[model samples]
Target: MPDLFLLNISASSIFDAASPEAASIRQLTFEFIIAASAVLLLVVILTSYITVKYRSKHRHEDPKQITGNRALEIWMVSVPLALVILFLFRSLATMNAILPDRGNHTPDIIITGHQWFWEASYPGTTVTTANEIHLPTGKRILMLLNAADVIHDWWVPALGPKMDMIPGMNNYLWLTINQPGIYDGACSEFCGQQHAWMRIRVIAQLQPDYERWLSEQTTNTHIPQDTMAKAGAILFLESTCSSCHRLKGTAAAGITGPDLTHFGSRQTMLTGMMANDSGNVARWLSDPQAVKPGAHMPRFIFAKDSIRALTAYLEQLK
Candidate 1:
C-alpha cells in the first residue's frame, strides 16, 4: 500500500511516515483511531437499540427503577479502565521506540531557530545556511535544536517527530529519511507576527548528492563577470546590505541575516515565503516590509536600475 503520509496527492493525505520514527508515530495513530472508532460505533449502536427497545409507545408507565446491577456497574467501570490501560501501554511502547538513541553514531547538525528563520550548521565545519535543510537518506541524523530568540518548533510531519526549539536549552531528535524528497514544514509554535511565515524545507537526497551539495555550500560565493553585476556587488558592500547578510569569499561577513553564499541555488527565498526569482528578489529589495510584514529587512528606496543590478548579482550567486 502507498504510504499515506508521504503522498502529495491531497492535503488530507499529505502527512506520511517517511522515516522510521514517523512510521512508529503513524502506527500509534492508526491504533488509537481504530480503538476510538470501535468505541464510538459500539456506543452508537447501543444507544439506538436502547432507544427503540424502551420507547414511550412500548411502555406507557415508568419503567421500574432498579438500583444498578452489580455486573452492569462492574462492567461499566472495568471495561473503560481496561481500555485505558491497554492504550497507555501501547503509547508507552510507541514512545520508547521513537525516543532518540544516544548510542547511535549519527551525523550531528545544529539547528538554531531564529525569530522568523531557521539556520542549520554541520558540526565541525564552517558550513551554515538558512531556511532549507539537506539530509542524506537512509542514515540516521542527530539534530540538536535550539532557539536564538523565543520558542519555535521544528516539525516535518513526513520525516519525524516535532521538537521544540527552546531558548537557552538544546533539545535533540533523531531522524532517518527512507526516501529522497523535499518535505515541507513550518513553525508550529506561535512566536511573533510572522510566525506563520516561518517555514522550512528539508531535502532528503542520496548520499552522494547530499555530499556534493554540502561541498558546494561550503565553497565561496560566485563572482559576477558582468559589469552590472559587478557594480551591484560593489553597491551591496558599500550600502547597508553587507551589514546583515553574509556572502562567503567576500568581505561581507555579517551574521544578522541569512547567508547568501549560494543564494541563486536556493529554490525559494525569505524562508520559503516566495520563489527565488529576479522579480521577487527585486520586489523584496524595494520594500521588504511590504512583501513580508515585520521582517527585519528594511525597505531600500533604491532606483529601479540599482534594484535590477542587485537582483542580477544575487541571481548569479549559484
Candidate 2:
C-alpha cells in the first residue's frame, strides 16, 4: 500500500538493518568499510610523502635510483596477508551465524517464486496468498524458497539476507522482524521483462494481528451480496479466468496463476504494479497487456458491464 512518495521511508534498505541477519550483514559491512578506509589513508599518506620527496628539482642532478626496499616489500606482503586472514575469519563467522546446520531443517513458511510474482503458503495450514506476505515480530521464521519457472531472488534489505530461488532446487532464508511496519522489496534477480515490476510487500505485525490475518487468509472466498457481484462471480468462474486462478469454495481451481481466494483483501494488482481500486481493477480486466507490457496475464477483452461487475465482485472479496 506504499505510494511512490512513501517509498523512501518504508522501502527495505540495507543501511537500516531491522532483523538479526541484516544486522550481522551491516556489522560486517561497517568493519569492511573501516578497514578499507584505513588502508586508503595509509596509501594516500605514503604516496604523498613519496611524491613530495622524489619530485624532479630544477637542478640537473638526478635522484638516487634503487631497487625496491626489502622492508617495503615485506610490509606489503605481510599487510595484505594479515588483512586477508582477518577478512576470511570475519566472513566465515558471519556465514556460520547466518547459516547454521541444525540437521533436517524445517520451515515455517514456503514461498514459491514465479515468472512475475510470488506465492506464499503456510505449512500445515490451508493458507495461501500472493505478492503480499505477512510476518510476525520477534520470531525467527524459517522460509523454504523455490522457483516455479526461472531463477528469482527474494530480497528484503531491511528484513534479512537475500537468497536465490532456483528451479528444481530449494533455498532457505531466515526472517526475524524487529518492528511492526511495512517493508517493500523487489525481485533482485532479473527473470523476464517485467522483473522490475515484480514487487514484494511484507507486513510485519504483532502476534495477535498476524494470527488474525492468517485466520482470515485461511477462510474461503467471499460470497457476493449484490446482483452485479453475483454476475461477476459467475463470469469469473465461467470464463478463462477460472482456468488460471483459483478461488476456494468454488469450481475455479487452477495452479498456473495466483490464487484469488481473497483478491479483494490485497492492496495492489499485477504484483504491486497499481492500486487496487474499482477503476484500476476494471482497467486491468479490460486489457492486462495495456497496463503491464510483457505480463503473463492475457487480456480478456471484457465488455464495460462485465468489467464493472467483475470489479465489484472482486472489491467485496475481503
Candidate 3:
C-alpha cells in the first residue's frame, strides 16, 4: 500500500525468440482451440439442421440406427495422432534450446534457494544479492538453481516453466528477456507455512541500466540523504535480526535470513513471495509470525522512533 514502490511482475519480450519449444506450445494451444471450436460449431449446426429437417410431418416409421462409421473413426484417431506428434516434435526442439550447454550462452548469475528466501551469487563476479534478480535484456542467462532446505520449485510463468530446486541436487534453466521489464516468479511446490510468501522478481533492463545496477550492487553505494534507510539499517543491526540476515556494507551479517542488501529496489519481497513496499516490509518487520506463522524471521518490536528510522533505512536500499 505504500506509494513508494509499484508492482509489475509480468513477462517481457526478452524471452520471445522463436524456439521450437515455444513454437510448439503456441501451436498446440492454437490447434486445441481450433479443434474445439470446429467441433462445437459442427455440433450446433448439425443439431439445428436435424431439429428442423427431421420434423414429424406424418406417422413415421422407425429411424435408422447406426453403430459406427469407419471413416469417422479413422479421422478421429489420425487427427489426434498427427497433432500429438507435431506437438512432441516441437516440444523436444524447444527442450533442447533450454537445456544447459546447448549453445554458446553465458549465465548472468547463479541463484540458490533457501527456506522462504532465495540467495543469488554471481560466480567469478564480486556480486551477490537476494530476492530480486537483474539481467540484461536480449541476452540469454542460465539460472543454476539449488536448494538449501527442502524441495522447492522456481517458476516464472511468462518466462518459462518451473524447475525444481532440491537440496544436494542442482537444476538449471535458461531465460532471455526481449525487453526491459520485471517478471514475477513463485515457488510452485509447497514447503512450509510461509511457502506462499516465497516469491521472486526477474528484472530485465537495458544494457546501460543493467550495468549501472551491477556497478551499484558491486560497490558500497549509499545515499547520504536517505536518512530513513540509514536508520532502518541501524535498527536491523541493533535488533536480533542480525542473527539471520546479511546486508552488504552493514554490520548485520547473519546468513540465517534473507539478504537485505538492495532490499528496497526489489519488486517483490520474501523471495519474490510478497510485494516489495514500505508497508509490507514494515508489516513483516512488525509481526512476521502473523503473516508467516512458521517464519524463521522474528518480529522486531521497535520503538516509534526506531521503527521510522528502520523503515527509512530499508527504503533507501533502492
Q: Give all candidates' CA lDDT scores.
A: 0.85, 0.88, 0.71
Q: What TM-score does each of the candidates earn? A: 0.91, 0.94, 0.76
Q: After superposing candidate 2, which stretches have Cα over 4 Å from the reference?
A: 1-11, 57-61
Q: Which sequence of candidate numbers ranks them by lDDT, best first?
A: 2, 1, 3
TM-score winner between 2 and 3, please give it: 2
TM-score of 3: 0.76
Task: Assess candidate 3 and give its lDDT.
Answer: 0.71
Report the alpha-carbon TM-score of model 1 versus the true structure: 0.91
Clashing pairs in 1: 5-15, 5-16, 6-16
Weakest lDDT window of 10 consecutive positions for candidate 1: 5-14
Q: Find the candidate with the highest lDDT and give its number.
A: 2
Tens-place lDDT per residue, model 2, 1-318, is 436633533646798888888899999999999999999999999999999997787869876888789999998899889999999999999988986774576898899999898999999889889998988999988899999999999998887688899999989887788888888888999899899889888888899999999999988999999999999999999999889999998999987899889989887778878777788888888888888888888887788999999999999999
How does model 2 score by TM-score? 0.94
Give stretches of model 1 more than 4 Å off.
1-15, 58-60, 101-107
Tens digit of per-residue lDDT, candidate 3, span 68-168: 99999999899879867876786676666556463554455777777788788876677788877788877667778889989888876656657899999
Position 37, candidate 1: lDDT:
97
Where model 3 places Cα greater than 4 Å from the true spot, the runs are: 1-24, 39-76, 100-106, 221-235, 249-251, 271-280
Pairs that clash in candidate 2: none
Candidate structures ordered by TM-score, highest first: 2, 1, 3
